[model samples]
Target chain A: MARLSRLVLERLMRYYRFLTETAAKEAVETITSGEIAEALEIDPTQVRKDFAAVGLIGMGRVGFDVCEACRAIRVTLGFNRSYEAVLVGTGHLGGALLAYPNFVRYGMRIVAAFDNDKQKIGQTVAGQIVKPMRMLKPFIKRRKIRLAILTTPAHVSQMLADRLVAAGVKAIWNFTPTGLAVPPDVLVRNEHISIGLAEIAYHLKDQAAC
Target chain B: MARLSRLVLERLMRYYRFLTETAAKEAVETITSGEIAEALEIDPTQVRKDFAAVGLIGMGRVGFDVCEACRAIRVTLGFNRSYEAVLVGTGHLGGALLAYPNFVRYGMRIVAAFDNDKQKIGQTVAGQIVKPMRMLKPFIKRRKIRLAILTTPAHVSQMLADRLVAAGVKAIWNFTPTGLAVPPDVLVRNEHISIGLAEIAYHLKDQAAC
Candidate 1:
């Protein structure tokens, strides 16, 4: 499978949430791609094309049930159960991520946090202890956590990622300024605040200029 | 003018920095969109189109000078100066946003924080006190702050936004889950962590599924 563009990934999440809610309501049996398009404000052709590319096919024109489609997407997304993630940096941002409530909404939770700071070490955030960086491997293995959130600084992002990869982290949600260069096998999604804010500032300027 | 996408806005900051370095070297005079395309790994035509859409046109063959293009983008982005923002919600995420150093890098800085928590009301983070929520209006107005970073919980987001909007805030970067329905004139951006994380999870699954 080719890596989906960030925009596509963002929209796919909405589709999943809509499907989940529709499933809960018990109003769906067979859903046409056009129905999804109508609900999501996307082109119907796009709906059919994207799902077909995902290798899921509903009965030709009979369509797919909301529950079945969501199940397929959920399974393909490895979201059948809660995902365990470890925070690589126990800094302010990392602490905030631990406290963020939305992770549990998607059945994902931070299982532990790692830091070299003595003051934060041994402290618990969101009920997960701030462990020494040395404990990363054993804790991740024990918890079967393959997802890691990298909130470390720009300078250390690469080094930290190297360590996490060595410790068996398969995916990272990177918030650092550093554009990580990871192996093809590792999955990384950049959500750097610096970039996000910069983008906003740029738009503000455009608005003002207009 | 067309609305600028978030990704382009963020890249404009990099463009600014690159132009500064180019100017300092005293070697770069006229620059082509192709050069920017090469440096940023963006398509040259795409770069030209974005700039063109903003009403900043480059000569067909002469292109644009690095410094000139940077200045044009800054003026268009309202970053020719600075914007002071206050963090609402002195919780961990708000505190972290207040402390982020790169906030200054893009000419926007968090000047203070506000929260309703009694204990945190007088406490200081990032050298700024956590003020009582009641003072949001006066302080924000007195400081002429129009842009803010909202880190409050979803349930309280509307109330907080209402207060901020009344306080004269025109734009908000919301870190909450709920998408706010602001006035058409007001800009509300949701910084949804769950959606972001879930997108990454889905991508990871997509890669593995195939």
Candidate 2:
């Protein structure tokens, strides 16, 4: 299978979510690219292309099998197995993510949370006890944890990323505003909260201009 | 200025963040597009184009004035003015966002939080007391709020969005998994947490395959 671009992967993930919901709620056996496209407000041709990219075929007018398409997306996106991850920075945002119910559905399980604050250390959050920063390296090594979710403050995020990488964590889901520098082999997916704000601000600005 | 695409807006936001930090921490007088691109891992040409699009001119060798560039980005992205927004749902995620300190920096102020849960109604999460759902409509109308930050459950998000639209919210920062159906005039930005998981999962899978 070819490596999918980030944009394509995002669309695929949306399709996967839509298909799964359609299958669960409506119990529909098959759905056309047009139906999925309409629901997602995506171009029908793009939907068909994405489906074909994942080896899913439509039966002309009969459309693609919903269950089959879901399975294909799941396999293509590597959601068949579970991924154990650790969470750093047991702040409000971190706590929100820890308590979030959807990570398990997406094949992620945050097994531990770490914080440098002595007050937060040993406190339980969403079933995982917050450990001190000192334990992070040993914990990652023992569990062979490859993923770390960094929700720490901007100033410390890069430092924590370095520590996480040195401890063998290969992928980081950075929720901080700080940009991290990691090795070529490491994957850093930054979730910038400000980007959303920028979009909203721009829209509001545009409206005011109008 | 012409309308910027979402991609351009996102890049502009990153540049704005970088420029602001550089100005504040290093007190840099001038910064080249190459410098910004290097820090952001973006193409220097693209950075220059973005700056140009925002009506910022760079000196031949001295580069663009750092503070000037920041101001241009701030005005372009509409971060120059403050925006009042209301957050729906006072769960951990909602609380986290309510307590988020950077929103002010990005020109967003979550003035109030609302939830249907009776227990959360009178409780204060982050200085602002959680208001009841019944009060949401009147509050938005009274304040003439144009933006709403939705952190509600997936099932209730669309319904609440409909109410928000009726109450005069022009933009919605949706944090739910459910895609909202709003009027064409209204803008909805869906923040899907699963997309990040999908990216991480794909990367991990690709590594395993290699």
On lDDT, the candidate that comes out on top is 2
Clashing pairs in 2: none
lDDT of 2 by residue, B141-161 (tens): 999899999988889888999
lDDT of 1 by residue, B1-210 (tens): 566676677667566666666677767788888887887668888888767755676876888866677778767676656788878887788888887776675678788788899989888888898899888899999998878889887779988888888888878999976566677666777777777766667755555555
Backbone clash tally (model 2): 0
TM-score on alpha carbons, each prediction? 0.78, 0.98
Encode model 1's per-residue lDDT on A89-147: one tens digit a residue.
87789888888766675667787889888888998877788899888888887776778
Residue B198 shift from truth in candidate 2, angstroms: 1.1
Best by TM-score: 2
C-alpha DockQ for predicted model 1: 0.45
Predicted complex 2: CAPRI docking category? high
TM-score, model 1, chain B versus true chain B: 0.83
What is every candidate's C-alpha DockQ against the true complex, given to 2 decimals? Answer: 0.45, 0.82
**Whole-model lDDT values for every prediction:** 0.76, 0.91
Candidate 2, overall lDDT?
0.91
